[model samples]
Target: MHNSSQPRTDAPSAASEPVIEVRGLAKEYRVFDKPEGLMASVTGLFNRKSRVVEALRGVDLRVEKGEFVAMLGPNGAGKTTFLKLLSGIITPTRGSATVLGSVPWERTDDFRRRFALVMGQRNQLWWDLPAAESFRLHKEIYRIDTPRFERTRDELVDLLDVRKLLLRPVRDLSLGERMKLELVAALLHEPEVLFLDEPTIGLDVVAQHALHRFLAHVQAERQMTVILTTHYMKDVAALCKRLVVVTQGSILYDGSLEQIVDRFTSHKIVTLDLDAPPDRAAIDRLGFPCEIRGPQVILRIDRTRIADVLPGILRGQGVRDVSVEDVPLEEIVAEMFRSGSTAGTDGATGAPR
Candidate 1:
């Protein structure tokens, strides 16, 4: 176990080398097709039909130490597949990846001791046993020193405020409580890399926020590298600065949230609160998509034309308030998922050319 009281002297010394690196990585599954009708099924038994489904394309990525990157995508987008490949849960069909200076599929004991994979939908603890028992098991499996194990477990339990729930059976705890314990279990060994797949799935807003705070605190303290796969935009916005959007077995966008919005969105949301209802003819002249709610007028205006257009709208009527904001991250991402276009994007950084 890592000694929490002292700084990690074992971290890679070269700052230029990424802790996680991938090139032309891909995965494919040969799924068999089954016939539906009884007669067809009987005939198909003699000759099976199968097709290859590409779960991940030839993707290239690099992540340095201590970076929290979030992978966002729709269903069947291969986000979980990438995480599994990196964590050594599954071998890739082609290409290569290295985590913490070792090939993940090799699954060396040294590498296994330095990383942890947590999937929200899967439970690592025994269902019938108390969480405390599971913690003891982890200590033994990891061969953690007694002092280090006790200190780490106590600190984590205190930080998450779940010391009281440790004695409860895993099956008895609520979803949120069990998640907290799961986190505690994963962290007990002080792994250098953490792979989280929808760790906040099915969690309430409060629970999500709590987990976010805990993750932020621990990452900062340990300088741990985390790669998260989650559908919750709130999780992406809250915990990760670097976002990678995947779709149709390929990366659609890879950059910061701000970069994604600026690249994909061409318009700004302008809302004006008028003292009186605006005239329809005048609103039409604005030449933008406009919606009127009571005395408030909302318009989606091109970013480049904002200077020329907004002055006219403000001067036209009794404008009590005017505000211009970028499109929400959620909307921009949804549009990317719908389009799945990589045009005008730099292959290296996913930035617009």
Candidate 2:
């Protein structure tokens, strides 16, 4: 696992001015209700019912020029909507945002040239063409000078180790290979700001790690500001120092990864290796949930009660070894999603209800 605690020493310092900024940013879609039967569908064509779905609400964020921030949330949490708004692919229904000193929705050519958006589920490259051909097309569309374009393309291809796959049609390559090419294509112009919506989704572990290393290296080398939305905790842990969690179309937590764990998790897992199988009733009397696995007992103890409960557990009949650990980050995030509560960063007890 990557040591996420260590900051990237080679990364350039952030510029004095923010590369991206937003205030009260929100988006809503009028989703028309579909009728099931033919007659009902015909009736609905004349009198359709519709409801508003808020994809983002009152979101405010500022990202410096060299920052790599991860956006995390469950499905239908508006993460993708947020990215589209930032990338100018979709206009917001309300509020305002600026990327690289220009309003993103304005879609100016200059602004378009300064950023890239990569969605894992979507393909920007032509399916029937070789990736090499697509690269050439990108060069023309971006009006990149021949020499500079070659230099950037070669460097990106080498970094991602996808040179051999360049001649293969995008439809012929594996998902992982296609994704690597996608990254290369997205970076051929060397965009200063990158918007990635689950770029590693559906990738195998090896591919995920490869992309992680490649992204970390590129972000550091170019000092690009990146906003990545992913459900994978490993992605957040391996790549980003800052984490912003969104759910129910609102910002729930915005802080360091360590801070999220410290603030939102209320319990720790305590494992006990005993001399022998312990009495179930006696363990139950301890007032914490425990699972007995042969000679080992695992207990989920509230953080506040650990100090009070440890001494008694250690003094138990067969107590021999004990260790305490925080609950897994995946579980913590899962609980947050299940609870659907707004979390404040003011205190340690600010866990979602």
Candidate 3:
């Protein structure tokens, strides 16, 4: 039901261009204090008090043309707010952001045509009408030509496997199927930048995996710049190399996934399958507590202490099998959040620790 007013189109990028450039981006909301009762309501209209809620503190970020980046954070970590700033949905109270060579808040015709926003919970399509109608609406709003629109639409429909669901009312489709259609509608114009907020929020395990695979395929095929906000670590591990961890309106860590493990953890889980219960004193000498269950002994060993201690554990003839492994990414991220790492650090560079 809407269309962006534009003059002419421009050429695509060279793949090395910086698609998103942000500096000291911040947003704050003035939340008014309200009181109960009719008298309070009347007085509030004339002289109401309010408090400033800083949803996003001074944050700096840069995303390359085709890089897939994951923005990780707790429940209220300003991840969504950051996306709004970059996508031009809202204006920043302070700082500047340049997305695709234009200020996002300007909401220019060029920017609107080149990017798409897909929120998992928010339904942009009509509830009573079929998804096909929504796709048609998007085409009209974006001013896509007939041949180009059909080609892109059919290609996305085939790639996402949503051809059968096109005729069904959006309200009737299953969550997974509906989500696929949503992505189809978002990408019909072949956008260069995609801002995805919790795209796999409530889908089942199988559906979640399918959606992730489809996203990987779409990104690879189209070379789109993607900014994904997610709590799911599996998505980060599978699809994203650059992770930006945010907490309490601040960037705690901005680096590669490997570097996060290195900077945060210094120990590995060493499990021993004991032929018989080991002497308690043997488990005690490792300097860390051992989790004992019947005959198997689970030891957490510091990387440095492993060389000194492994020989002693193996010397015990009762040892059946010993396995050493790095701590899992889930556990590492949980540990980082446990420490309440909301204080600001240098994240603008998107560099390793």
Candidate 4:
């Protein structure tokens, strides 16, 4: 849990500027026809057919010097491809993208020094070495001065609560500990921008929250720019104020999480537990769109009409306990994919009675 009252003092230096700017960026791959039979293979070497698959189509994005943004999408949504393009591991087939005002695909030493990319499924650290040794290797690789490297390493270990794990071998450490060490390695250079692809993928709840708090602190204190692609809704809800939702190889929505909820879903679910089983039929007769789950009854009411209807619903239904909450973000995201209408940032305009 975050100490909400604690004030964050981290801010970017005045010299720092928009670290990432992308426009009309796209990547496509060609698939060649393969001969299955030996007889067919003999002739296919001379003649073949192929088709193009677009991994990214006209993706445009911008990240300010100190902003934290979350990129949300289901699997096969081209999120990984976009990150790879930005990391300079793969070149884009079309358009332009700039990291710290330099095209990453160029693989310039200067551009490489300005950012770090961490893929959850990939490990940059040496498996047999202690995690601390990995950080030392990164310092040498990045050519950081001795004093600066030590300071940064100490700060990161303290912030991430991985001081004890750093001395352990990477293979022996727990999954969460390895992730923390991986993060330390990624940040030892203090790149201007950070790209995190599911950094908390396999972490337990406690580890997840700890990592989230540490990231929040980094963003607040260092003013480090971040672009995170994650499947966890809790990650988005806690760490990101803005989001870019992608699906089917295109950016579907780019805005605040609050706005996403407001536009896609208009109903708030209210759960009620009566002292005695209230007249279920009478409650059903009120017709406010409800579903009963054993001892609890859930009512969906328009956000606008919640106050107006709550009093009456409680009075007539003899409610004993009630709690109100927005519809799950997952359901809203699913609806967006199903509708196939990538236009509105606000939710649909239906009001529940």
Candidate 5:
């Protein structure tokens, strides 16, 4: 965290340019192969065996200011690697990326100050020291003006309702409290771009909800650009309007949260909650894809069958409540990964309904 009265003097582009521009960005790691034999170990000094692991391959993307985009992927899909490259933690093996018009790997004072990254698995605060001490270190590191620092700190602490916890040791706080403090610490600089990597990882539902609310408020109030990688669909539904789904270090889909369902899933789910448990044979006779969970019968009906199937589903059932929804985003995304079809930035169309 570094700051200046005049920032980005060496920026290759103007403020009007995209907040982030990535072209053919890629990262690869040389992993050493170890052998058990003493003879092999003796020769390893002269000739070591290694294999290249491609963490990211030719990923092209652009992000505009004030947009909250979610990056979705499975384990080892390079989601973490992409964040590391963009945040300048590691150099890309090939291609290039410009963040706020400056190459991120440059690690310039101006460039570093403009972005903040929050990783759920890592802790930036001093474990033994009071959170306020860490907050002061941030102020000093960023060279934040005194009055401005105090104002910003107060605003953040108040927003998170952790004013009292600031003086408490970070290790003394619960996981949720520590996360709140981490958010405050990352945001004290008021970065223009925020990178969140599974920020809600281990939190219970209530804590996740609070953090989400705070994030939404901060993004809206400041119009800061945000790129987040998360597995929690709740976070996506609450924060992101756009999504970029990746698998095997390649982007599979990039579009609206809504379009993902339409593009990947050919069917919709209609849930029928019955007054009493219905006979399983009645549903089985329909010969439609359905599930029985207690008194509720969940149907996965093709789009064309909704009109015809809904009536038959409701005809003999003791329907107490009924609801219809597009296939869940999680299901659609999993499907997209399973079938590598169209789901790109240009609206890559998938199978027809």
Candidate 6:
């Protein structure tokens, strides 16, 4: 039987090397023009024109063993394209990528055995059959020995909390329940690397939190390398210590989330709730830019001047309640893209503060 405590080293290793190495990875798709009218359609069929949609343009990435990294970007920002290239689902048109020292698109049996890709929107389990049965079938497909399969399956079920739901048909399970089963099935063989594409997508808050905890546990206990692509900023912020932010088919901000915030915005929103609406002139006399919205007074205080400006606003306004908060990450990122602030260092690339 496989031991839960032992590290899985079944895959081929090139002198205990990095799990993944990518350089100048790029992919492009031909954009076909739709015919304007019936005559144009008939003509276009005969003489078609196309444009290049650069899904991923020269993305340079490297992932080490046992490191959990998150890839974040808005829709159509090349995050999915990059994951597909790494998983060998789609081949990159340029550059090179190696997973466990093997070319991803090569379809080698050894390489296939060493990794698992779990896509949240895609269902891998059989709809009609019990999830346990599907897992058993996959165990055979993976050729996992009885002892090893039992040990891994049991461990995954316990960790993912899907033991009771395993015998139920996959189609009958709730979204959260199905996700739990999917996780167990994917990890049944203890793949060295796990690629999660929106693994927490479409889940409720509680379900999302559950999955997040499970992922954290799996990372800590197994020491497996994971490359996650997620649009949910909360998932990225909570799980990922390092990150790569891709936009317009390129790596735009590839550092810490905190760095992104710090570099993009210097304005802090400080809210002060007053017992009564304060005078506009009195609020402005504090010498800081302030806005009165409802019963609250907000200040657009600069990061450098927040300390000096905050106390004055409260003391001057006779504040009943006060709060200090950095601008949301989403707003900062939006501003960065809108202002065209691409290709610059923010700060720590290793992890978020």
Each candidate's lDDT (Cα)? 0.85, 0.85, 0.81, 0.79, 0.83, 0.77
Alpha-carbon TM-score of each model against the true structure: 0.91, 0.89, 0.87, 0.85, 0.87, 0.87
**Candidates in descending lDDT order:** 1, 2, 5, 3, 4, 6
Top candidate on TM-score is 1
Worst 10 residues of 6 by lDDT: 1-10
Shift in Å, residue 264, candidate 1: 1.3
Provide the clashing-pair count of each candidate structure.
0, 0, 0, 4, 0, 0
lDDT of 2 by residue, 109-228 (tens): 999999999999999898999999999999998899999999999999998999999998899999999999999999999999999999999999999999999999999999999999
lDDT of model number 5: 0.83
- What RMSD does each model have against the real structure? 6.6, 5.6, 7.2, 6.8, 6.9, 7.5
For candidate 4, which ten residues in a row score worst on lDDT?
1-10
Cα lDDT tens digits for candidate 5, 168-283: 99989988999999999999999999999999999999999999999999999999999999988899999988788776677766777776676667788889999877788888
Q: Look at candidate 2 and give me any clashing residue pairs.
A: none
Residue-level lDDT of model 4, residues 11-127, one tens digit each, is: 222445567777778889999888799877877788877899877777777677788988877787778898999999999998788888898889999889878998888888899
Q: Please estimate how well model 6 matches the true structure, expressed as its whole-model Cα lDDT.
A: 0.77
| Cα lDDT of model 1 by residue, 90-185, tens digit | 999998999999999999999999999999999998899999999999999999999999999999999999999999999999999999999999
Residue 242, candidate 6: alpha-carbon lDDT: 66
What lDDT is reached at residue 42 by model 1?
A: 93
TM-score of 2: 0.89
Candidate 2: regions farther than 4 A off: 1-15, 305-308, 315-321, 341-353
Report the alpha-carbon TM-score of model 1 versus the true structure. 0.91
Cα error, residue 216 of model 3, in Å, equals 0.9
Candidate closer to the true structure by lDDT (higher is better), 3 or 4: 3
Which pairs clash in the backbone of model 5?
none
Error of 1 at 20 (Å): 0.4
